[model samples]
Target: MSQGDEQRTAKVEPLRKARPCPECRRPSTRDNYPFCSDRCRNLDLSRWLKGSYAIPVADDESKADDDYRD
Candidate 1:
């Protein structure tokens, strides 16, 4: 194969860096990505299901006052 052909076959985009698992500080797997294993992934899911992880909702004073008047 010619050098030009080999160059054309090469990857055009930059490779992504491997991110550590959120639950455990370990290299992630293809199947259980973002988490190292099923156990770690399940634990995270349980937290969410049990309302352990919450997103804080800021109450807008002006909007609430106008829209939700009794």
Candidate 2:
């Protein structure tokens, strides 16, 4: 291969460093990323789909009622 072709085909490193998989706590893979494998990735998705992960909201019933009345 020519020098120009080599330069064009050279692999570029990711700007951010790889982090450990959130589900398995193993080194993440380039293919799966954020997760070590498809299993871990799907597990996380399953949790989200099943409502296992949720954002907490503070209950303010009085405030909500006031808004509706206004």
For all candidates in order, the CA lDDT equals: 0.84, 0.92
For candidate 2, write residues 17-63 as lDDT tens digits.
Answer: 89999997999998998899999999999999999999987597788
Candidate 1 global CA lDDT score: 0.84
lDDT of 1 by residue, 7-58 (tens): 9999876255667899888988767887889999999999999999988865
Native-structure RMSD, model 1: 4.5
lDDT value, candidate 2, whole model: 0.92
Assess the local accuracy of residue 12 in candidate 2 as a C-alpha lDDT between 0 and 100. 96
Question: For model 2, which pairs clash?
Answer: none
